[model samples]
Target: MIFFIYQIVTKPLTSKLIRNEACPVCNTQDSLELTLYMRYIAMLIPLFGMGRRTSVICTNCGNVLKNPDSSIFAKKKYSNKVADAVKDIRQNHKRTLWQLVYPWSIWFILPFLILILLGISAINKKNTEEKAKEYAELIMHPQTGDIYKSTWFENGLSQGVLVKLMRINGDTLYVVKTKQKIQMSFSKDEWNKLSADPAAFEAKEYKIKNFSILKETNFGDLFMYNNDENGKQYPIYLGAILNSKCEMDLGFETIERKK
Candidate 1:
């Protein structure tokens, strides 16, 4: 199939005979006829060709001869201008047909372009991972005015809390929402858990009030008054942490959640 192609095929010209002379092979009178056919191969491989062929058939003996040469053939040659014209017609079509199929070579450069695209994709993935690690270091020292956004993660931190610190009292971090003071505390254990997905950490919108921080301790005695939906309060005592920023970098964060 690689040798297949479409092309403009021109018609070949022909002649009747050498006045229907006698056959040289069978010695039959008015039986030998002559013809001139010409064609060339244009595709990768030739399907058919009658390149400069001289065909003769004897009507009386039914003998056929093709491409009979002048030296091997011992018949009286036609000695007129008509015989010379037939030879010229066959020779005109003997040149090369290579120009008809030169465009097929353009399909050879497709594989190199595909490999270049795959190399670019691998480099992009490595850059995204480095950016995620650098972003975690930016929030290492959280201040009272520092604002955080929501965390959208596929891991344990998906749809997590975000808040801006309005006040930091000792180990206590407070944010004001709806004219109410919402206090949060991050113990060593709580900090370790929250910052685990540092890349997904973010600040929350003040109008969005769905967050949770039940088992964290800052104001030691005040945590006793709060709990989950249950009437019990579970507290995680901060282990020698002076500020919420240091606690957050340790992996803990606080969010308000509805019971």
Candidate 2:
């Protein structure tokens, strides 16, 4: 019984296996020894799965086995998945020619748009300045009063002189000295030129007087002509109008004095 048990223990397990050994279960010499490599391959089948290439099976007993060749398995699976993905991508791919062109087109177009906007703004600013200057020039000229409706002048020289003159009455003109420090000044002749023809004055040469502050309520006109004061009765053009101010000079010279 011990010898029988030893025979059974020493026997091979499968018939289709490569080695000629007796069967362990029945003690029959018809059994064959299973190859270690084949056993190893069989063990790896479930682990590797059906996706693998090198498969195995016992020819006589028909036992399913695994043969995991990592290189072949990986290559076949990777190739199949990659091929399927490539086919799907090809089917779904849309040709967007506009997408490639838009960014570069915007790079050129944006600058042109900016330049056009800047040009329009500059034109608007120029027109505003010209209108202001024209109004200022018109207000400066004593004769232009009939041409424009709302226009007035205040002191001797609005731009040139620091000392602002105010008309007290027909006989006297009051002088208001400015406390705020200013740099520019005008000569008597320069003041005369400005008073005579304000259009002739250059904007770059002189700054506009502070017209907002010097109104009729704060500082009256320096030279107001009554019926008897001047030979011809005309209102003084000494205050600030729309754009330009009265020609300011060093001396508080009235319109009568200027004449």
Candidate 3:
């Protein structure tokens, strides 16, 4: 008669019994040690029993085995679930990191660059308006204060002559006719205390009365205009105009003389 003797070892199993054993499901040889203490801890839990105690696990197939209870294969099931959850979390984390880094590294800089570009565009438009105003002032006759026009006459009959007028203030310019008015009225204190405040004062209008083109024998033809009937077309020098109440003043400086 033969008798089978079974003994429990106190020392934890260190040497692997099935070293490099390939899992039948996934054919992986990787395995980890599961000590008896860890097995006891797992077994004490209500969710784990002796049959579901810790043991070596196949890294690939996730299979588990026990010396006593292979039927209690709870560890393999739990491990597989945990592994799947971990894999999903890792994948999602990787995707999230990539998404955040990609935009911040490349696309995020666009807003600042776009703002700079918009600023440059606005500055360019302002500069262009200023230059256009300066050119218009250059083309206008300073004496007559009229825009110049070139025309051709047929049989001493000149028709369809183009007329233009331009005016400049600061960096801005306007076109006006001899019959129209551009009044500039202000108090003396206001004129003396000229400031950059845009709302400080209001502008008035003045009309152009007389305008004519004259021919000089020695010099070229001249263009002249007057704000009053008796006002002669003299070379306009710098001067200041005072209001009747002495509360307002206006200053003028000739930039050019028409010929």
Candidate 4:
């Protein structure tokens, strides 16, 4: 398993010479520079209480000494100038008494935030690919040069019935009106009985104006189940009008290609 790693770093926050003082190592008066500095930590918060120390350096004999405490200044010869500088630094640069360490909880949450964004991106990509596949399956009727050879519900096919796709704009297909050619020609009274049904009509030309894509649509309630008694689901985009009121959904089945 791979894991992400984070690090905490330390850097110098302040470094400056306070004043000239006597070197303790070289025993030279007014020959050393008393310096006080702090090394701050860097992580998720502003932190500074780690190893704050002081260093004294001699100018005459090139000697240096270091200590964690500032009390080494008391061993030197009494100099009012160095003492005033030390007093000013102690008063102005004191660490906060409230917090010796900072809270680090936010650093643990960054990795989880990155994971949630990646999961949402993957789901959206899969949905886009599924939509593209559904569009490719629409049947294209040759005489009309439109519509796909969609799947039919079992026993849904009227014998010798031809479904001619006229035009496809969005999810709706404009089917051209046709006179029944497969069944015996209907009598005038029989024609009147079936005139309202799309299955009872027939078409001759591709350029006819009687083409209507929508049935008696109810704007408030536009989709109803088509006459599939077994509750079989088909692709709505394939012109499978299962219900009187209609909308579209993605298809799972695809047409098998010839090898």
1-259 per-residue lDDT for model 4 (tens digits): 9864444443333444544456656777767665555544554654534444555456678675544344644465435665566456655665654233434434666688778888887776676566444333332212243322222222444211224455555544345333432332223343233232455445542221211323223211112224366787322222232211213322322222222
Return the TM-score for each candidate structure.
0.25, 0.22, 0.21, 0.27
lDDT of 3 by residue, 75-111 (tens): 4533454344333433443222322342135467688
Is 3 or 4 the stronger prediction by lDDT?
4
TM-score: model 3 vs. ground truth: 0.21
User: How displaced is residue 197 in candidate 1, in Å?
Assistant: 28
**Which is better, 1 or 4, measured by TM-score?**
4
C-alpha positional error of residue 101 in candidate 2 after TM-score superposition, expressed in Å = 9.5
Q: Report lDDT (Cα) of residue 132, candidate 4.
A: 43
Sort by lDDT, best first: 4, 1, 2, 3
Off by over 4 Å in 1: 1-114, 151-163, 169-172, 176-259
List candidate 3 stretches off by more than 4 Å.
Answer: 1-59, 62-114, 141-259
TM-score ranking from best to worst?
4, 1, 2, 3
Write candidate 1's Cα lDDT for 139-193 as tens digits.
Answer: 3333455444323232333332333446555444554212111123334443333
Span of ten consecutive residues with least summed lDDT in model 2: 5-14
Considering TM-score, which of the candidate structures 3 and 4 is the better prediction for this target? Answer: 4
